[model samples]
Target: MSIPHGAASAAARPDRVDPAVRRIGATLVVGALGVVFDTTVVSVALDDLAKAFDAPLATVQWVSTGYLLAVFVTIPLAVWAQARFGGRRLWIAALGGFLLGSVLSALAWNATSLIVFRVVQGLAGGIMMPLMATLLMQAARGSHPGRVMAIITVPTALGPILGPVLGGLVLHLADWRWMFFVNIPFCVVGGWLALRNLPDDRPEPGGPRGRLDVVGLLLLCPGVAALVYGLSRVEGGAGTTGAAVLVPLLGGLALVGGFTARSLTRPGGALIDLRLFRHRAVASSAALLFLGGIALYGPMMLLPLYFQQVRGEDALGAGLALIPQGVGALLARALAGRYMDRVGPRRVAVTAFALVAVATVPFAFVTAGTGGAVLMAALFVRGIALGAAMIAPMGAAYVGLRHQEIPDAGVITRVAQQIGGSVGIALLAVVLQHAAAGAHGPSALAGAFDRAFWWSAVLTALAVPLCLLLPGRPEPPPPARTTRTGEAVDPRRPTV
Candidate 1:
């Protein structure tokens, strides 16, 4: 096949991202923004939603909970769905589903209806999240993974920074429905971009397509959902001893265990390829990502609460206070990507995790009287380290993976990070509850938060050594070959 002039130029310039990869990454980011932003944006509006529908907080909480559960339930399906349909078709369809759900959610007459619509959103959003990474990685064809991942991660980095601020502004200035309305433009623009820029790579008719693994889906989907649900209940202060927490936790574990056994027995046909775990890059990246999730998310739960309960900030004020952390995260992206592409993921991840642990130490001593400037400085440092920590392992996960294997790797890494987040939030919530038991004043509550932050720092520190397990400095790509017509072409680049 003749190489396009743009492809030839990209092949010759090893440091520059391919024009095609950039286009795909940009398209995916536009679509992914709605999903990422929606997750955080709806969080700040729960109180308003409760009052708007005149429903109890517990029942209304399902608007978030249902969406989350639906997300988990459908996450395992991304690889299969992408295989069954082409990436381009799946992307547009999922974007449309999210848009439809967003509109319905805006018009929801009650909490139940809102929860249902949010689930619809979740089902689509879940597929898009992992598939976004899969499509980008596949298109990248193993070149400049660090740079590609940096682009892929933009929506995620921005979500925590912008979602809450936007949500707060919407609630203050307009009706709650505007929260869902905000998703419309992202979905519409993203879909249009996908149609225009994404390559149509659907499988040929009657080609060998992987069949849906019905039994695996039944076992894993509900299993992960149950696990996440149980952990969420813990975060809600239900305690670990309650039937509400124990039943789901145990059942989820058993189902997951069953899926694992079944997958091992039938590796080739399983919903996700268990054999990928044998690859050090994939295995180590998943492990580090799990811990990274804890480091990033556990502290996330505490930081906002610390601002609110100890510092007397309202929701908007708390969101505003977090801007420093978000800024640090944004700043870390380019530097982290550059270094990971240079010295490899190992050095970057280890240094990043160590920095994260060190930065978190300031929170361990937090008091109601702590200076805002001091706390913000610490958060800024932590955010930079956290951003680097996430980028390294994520990019490393695809190192040495084949084109067809990228989708399964995406699903694996994403699930690990998410489950880790749930575990971190649940564990920290329990620790805070116990530490703050019968706390009489802000000082005592601050003491309790200190203990929780200590735990967060300790967990983060544990991931540092694990970072060593990631692949070291990447080997340089072989020089491109020239066709008889003198056109440079990359042998490794897969045709989309």
Candidate 2:
């Protein structure tokens, strides 16, 4: 039954709790840290990976590109996997898979071998990321969703804050292999906590359970991966190559289109629940997510390079210089979370995007002699905006979805953000590279970077309109009849 206004639901009944809700929160936080760290650590090590393996930068980038592709490919399968297997079983397996891949990556003999190992890691890592949210939210049982989201988000929020710093320290002190090794402790601890604290609830048996959607997956995975790969290729390699990047991109579009059409006509076994898009909040928030990713991740890819290329700093120095931005982001998350709960996500997102545009404008005019203090101030402000930009869109997307539909919703939002990041990074890289090619010395390079940053500001500005679509404030939860389980409810109908 629907929990009454400001009242706890069955999932949060004090008498029903196995131990306490906060302990369950602890486990989810720890598990999420491991998954988030692994995703960003490899990003810092790409240059090292290329040098050690004696491969070109383009070839070595596959180490990351492959992993991202694998994540996109496997994300749609999480709900089904949770249904076919138990949540606890799947989470443990996902953690184990990542651990295995990390060990293998450490010992890889060449670039080709490394790419293969990274893909395995990506597949496992992919599952762990969303499962962190799925299990924790499920356990909380629609009581204190705000608090539950905050706990699970701490690590996710920290990744951008801590990843580059940690990756830089490891690269400076040790070899690239240590980056992969770092994941071991997290995996071990997370798996142990999950086994101990997680619930034993099996899937709702009468839901969409049966044959897997092989055709749906075949269409969706390769379609997304190809589009992303093509984008990366343009960034690495550009001209007809840049224009021609659209070939696989178009093919990927066609494939996704076909799969979407196929899934709609099928029974409950559709690969993704396309019907969720009917929610105005979900659809618009997803659009904001796609654009915000382009804006945030685009600069994320550029800021370090600007430090290294224009300011002549080493990898560690560039990372150290970027810490202000991270610190700004970490500090703003709590404030943003509280504001989102009280004022609604729409205003928070719109205001954040505007601040992001303002903060980024300073970079468009950056110079060789630009004061470090001034640059750091700009980054800090940008990070605050970054925190708000990231959190509000996520909060808004799930504003209307029911507890059961949440897992599927999580999958959709994560995929959009990830794929959007891939696109943003690739496009920004191409922009910067093309801009730099027109210049020679540091001064010329600075000018080119300015041109690219200008574009980023425009993209950030574009995200403002999309925020209007988010629900204004929290509505009362759905009524009792809709939420109760174990009745003859049709699987095909909407839960809300």
Candidate 3:
């Protein structure tokens, strides 16, 4: 009846990371980039996918939606998989699975088939993203996390900014299939590196690694999948009636709630560590991530529409216009990371949120006749603010968590962000629909978009105070010592 608090062995050697660990970290980043690249690539390629399959836009949209829902379904399984199979093996397997799925997707001929293949990719992707975090954080157990996190997050920070750009470029010259093909080399290299360099951090003796939680997976996966499905439906003109939306949504809630109750009573490391919720920092980080998700992605949906609908730009032209935002985001990541290290999550998050609020204000003033110069400047500022805001709070969430706990945090933050995006998209869609209902011309649609921007700005502002709640400066790294056998040992073990 006792909880296994000593989940990883305390006496294990933990000294300076070997060259192998460093190599593995770099390889994981490459693999991580490939995952993000695929995610962004599909966003840019949706139209092409639909056209190629001769499917309706609504149906084809599930290609992305299904992939995301599949991610949610698979994420909780990472903890169990890692405990049973070891982090190295699981990661290499995930990368291989992703590569295989990408190949299948590229070869798919119909929208339905592509969606199914995308789901396969998503399931594997879901495992990789969090496991990457888990493994890195665990490896850096006795090290300075600020520096380690900075190194790990570079690609994640770059992915959003670059994904669209790369996706656009691919669409311009090569076919959509090339995006999937691109992942092949990265996966092969990543797998090889994982096999060669990834550390072997096995579960402690007597740690929970028994039968799979069949009932839990059934409830949890479907629950999350249904909720995301419902949200995606909201954007597909299924306002309330054309909606089979409520069915999955309500069912999802019930399943999640049921599984949660079961997890609390059953055993160690419940699909997600519900114990993490007890931490105020984790809870607040999740809430802010939800709001930040809205700020980050909601405008993405609106901006492209404004460019095409009001500014009369083609897809390529619109992509070009978005370049400034990406450039600004790329420029801000390092500075933001360094600041987060020095001043802690609170100051960094608050400052970043303020900048985001200020930057987003310009969107409220956008008009049909607004000059491209002014809009570009606004987007640039917004991008910089977005970059800082995104990384600061993410760093904050793991401020005090131990090595093994980081994976759970990754799942938590990711799910929070995605769910937030779904809500933001649906809410903004409805708001714009209502806002645009009153008029018939370009000016009217512009006015509707402006209204949406104002709301998004308000949402960004609301997160500022929450950011203030994040913990101040991180603790110093643990000290390392050596035993007669020459294995590194953590000095903090006795104290814990």
The CA lDDT of each predicted structure is: 0.90, 0.77, 0.77
lDDT tens per residue, model 1, 266-289: 948799887899999999999998
Better of 2 and 3 by lDDT: 3
| Predicted structure 1, TM vs. truth | 0.97
lDDT of model 2 at residue 106? Answer: 88
Off by over 4 Å in 3: 1-22, 202-210, 240-242, 265-269, 485-488, 492-496
Model 3 per-residue lDDT tens digits across residues 1-496: 1112222333342323334345556878987888877776677778898899999988888888888888888888887888788888899889989999999998998999999999999999989887887776666553444445555666666666567777778788898888788889889888887776776656556776645678888988889888888877777667745548778778889999998888777757477776787787888889988998888777777887888888888766777788888777777777776677677778888988889889888878888899999999988988888878877767677777765677778778878887888888877877787788867778888888989989989988999989878988866545567779875566643322
* TM-score to native of every candidate shown: 0.97, 0.89, 0.89
Clashing pairs in 2: 2-480
Q: Give the Å error, residue 70, model 2.
A: 1.3
lDDT for each residue of candidate 2 in 346-448, tens digit (9 for 90 to 100): 8888899999999999999999889999999999999888888887877776765676677777777777877777778887787788888868888999998
Rank by lDDT, highest first.
Answer: 1, 3, 2
The model with the greater lDDT, 1 or 3, is 1
Superior candidate under TM-score, 1 versus 2 = 1
Worst 10 residues of 1 by lDDT: 1-10
Q: Which residue pairs collide in model 3, if any? A: 14-488
RMSD values, in order shown: 1.6, 4.6, 4.6
- Point out where model 1 deviates above 4 Å: 1-5, 482-487, 494-496
